[model samples]
Target: MAGLITILIDGITYASWLFIVALGLTLVFGVLKILNIAHGSFYALGAYAAASFVGWAASMKWAPGLSLVAMLLAAVAVAALVAPLTERGLLRFFYGRDEVLLVLVTYAMFLIMEDVTKLVWGANPYYVSEPYSLFGNVDVGKQSYVGYDFALVGLAAVVGSAVWWGLNRTRIGKIVTVVIHSSEIAASMGINVSRVYMGAFAVGIFLAAIGGAFTAPMISVQPGVSVGVIIVSFAVVIIGGLGSIEGAAVGALIVGLARSIAVHTAPVAELFSIYIVMAIVLMFRPEGLFQRIQARKI
Candidate 1:
């Protein structure tokens, strides 16, 4: 029973983090119809930014409780500063280009940002673990867990619900949905489709940034961190189905639990467990679990 509880907690905690990042990836694909390879760069950038901010706060002897706020602000700053610059300055020009070309462009951007991070932050791993323990701990049976981990689970739930509501219940969401269904039609109907695209992309950036920011305290913030995240995020979204928020959520849980089970049972399979599941799922449902087959206009 204790073992099962541990697995449940570990799986949920890990899934929360995956969902946060995967949500952004799926959102960008859903609205922009572009597979942004640079999304992971945004995640790395957010981690670096948060590390800098929270480190500065620590150096200034600010209240430790406020480190969480600093992390949030760091994410907001990245979203505000980098999102528009990337979307409008770079991606906008490639909008009508071949989708393959756009993917390559973002991949190039990701490579560039990797070096940019090293140039600005140096190659040293930044340790911002002080805030990780601020929330105290939770004791379950003979095991102990971090309160922050549970907090992440709650955060994921809130974020998932909020995104679902924003996309389904809000007016702007309706506009975005219309644009998603057909951008040309939305533009013909007097909607500023470009603006909608920009907004959705920016929101996606914000989510990616927050995922990194929150994760910074739990791990070393350093260069090359973005690669692994992007790889796994692709797995999650692919398993859950691209462009589906519900798919992202479900996919994250699936990956997280599968990984946890592998780690506890057969450590040798930990790395490949996610991919194995992905392969199995794809063999059955190539469009993913939540994606519908769109009738392409011939």
Candidate 2:
């Protein structure tokens, strides 16, 4: 019973951060129709930014709890500064091009960003462990867990609810939805489709950055971190159905649980467990669990 409880907690905690990252990836795909291969680079930027921000905060002798605010600010800064340059300066030119070409373009951007990160942060690893203990510890039956983990679960719920409400209940969200369905029609209707795309891309990058910022304390912030993150994030979005917010959530949960189970039971299978589940899901639903089959247009 204790072991089961531990697994559940571990799975939920892992799923929380993953859902945040995957949500951004799906949102970008849904609105912009661009599968951004550079999304993970933005995440790495956030982590590196967070390390700097939190370090600065500590040097200033700010309250320890404010490190959270510093982390949040790091994400916002990355989105605000980087999103426009990427979307308007580069991506906008490639609009309406072949999807394969877009993929290649983003892949090139990913490689460029990877090199840029190394140049800026160098080869050394950065650790932001100060924020990890802010919430202290919570005892769950026979096991004690970090309170920060529960906080992430709560944060994920809030982020998900906020995004859902914004999209379903707001005027701008309605306009964005129309753009998603048919950008040409939306533009004909006088909506600023370009602005909508920019906004969606910014929000998506923000989600990825925030995920990395908050997760920095949990692991070493270093080069090559983005590779694993992008891979797993792609798995989550693919399993949940690309562009579906709910799919990202469900997919994260499935991947989290599968990994947790593998880690606890057969440690040797930890790496393959996620891919195995993804392959099985793809076998039954090539379009993903949440995506519906669309009729082919000649």
Candidate 3:
């Protein structure tokens, strides 16, 4: 029973972070139809930004609780500054091109952003652990978990619910959906498809940054963090089916639990567990668990 409870708590915490990152990947793919390889770079940048901001806040003698706010603001700043620049400055030009070519473009962007990060932040690791203990701890069964962990679970739920509602229940969501179904038709119908693309891309970048910011306290913020997240997020998005919010949520849970189980039972299989699950899911359902077969128009 103790083991089971531990697994559940750890899995849910892991899933929360994965969902946040994968949600962005799915959102970008859903609306923009762009498989952004540089999304991971945005994540890394967010972590670095949060670490810097939170460190500054600490040095300024601000309240420790406000560090969370600083982290959120870091994500917003990244979304506001980087997303538009990337979209308008580069991705906009690549629109209507071959999908494969667009992907390569993003991969190139990822490489450039990596070097940019190194030039700016150098190679030193940043440890922003102040916020991790702000909320204190909670005792669940025999396991005492940090309150921040549970807070993250709540944050994930709120973010997921809000995105789902915005996409399904709001008017702007309807417009975005129309754009997603067929941007050409949307533009013909007098919709500013370019603006919609920019908005959606910004939102996607925001989510990625939020994931990285929130995760910064738990890990050392440094180079190479982006690579792991992009890989895992891709797995989650692929397993959930590209462009599917619910699929991203479900896929995160599945991968999280699978990894937790592997860690507790067979430590040797920890890294391979997620890929094995992805392979199995792909073998049975090529389009992913949530995405339907999109018909190719001749």
Off by over 4 Å in 1: none
State each candidate's clash count: 0, 0, 0
lDDT of 1 by residue, 1-298 (tens): 9999988888889999889999999999999889999989999999999999998898899899999999999999999999889999999898868999999999999999999999999999998887889879999999999999999899899999999999999999999999998999999999999999899999999999999999998888888899999999999999999999999999999999988999999989987999999999999999999998888876
TM-score of each: 0.98, 0.99, 0.98
Least lDDT summed over 10 consecutive residues: which range in candidate 2?
289-298
Compare the candidates by lDDT and give the number of the best one: 2
Cα distance off (Å), candidate 1, residue 67: 0.5
Q: What's the C-alpha lDDT at position 113 in model 1?
A: 94
Error (Å) of candidate 2 at residue 54 is 0.1
Instruction: Put down candidate 2 lDDT per residue, 28-94, tens digits, no spaces.
Output: 9999999999999999999999999999999999999999999999999999999999999999999
Flag the better candidate by lDDT, 1 or 3.
Answer: 3
lDDT of 3 by residue, 1-298 (tens): 9999999888999999889989999999999889999999999999999999999999999999999999999999999999889999999999989999999999999999999989999999999999999889999877889998988989999999999999999999999999999998999999999999999999999999999999999899988899999998999999999999999999999999999999999989987999999999999999999999978888
C-alpha lDDT of all candidate models, in order:
0.93, 0.95, 0.94
Tell me which residue pairs clash in candidate 3.
Answer: none
How does residue 271 of candidate 1 score in lDDT? 72
lDDT of 2 at 3: 88
Q: Which of the two candidates, 2 or 3, achieves a greater lDDT against the reference?
A: 2
Q: Which pairs of residues clash in candidate 1, taking residues 3 or more apart in a chain or in different chains? A: none
lDDT of 2 at 278: 99
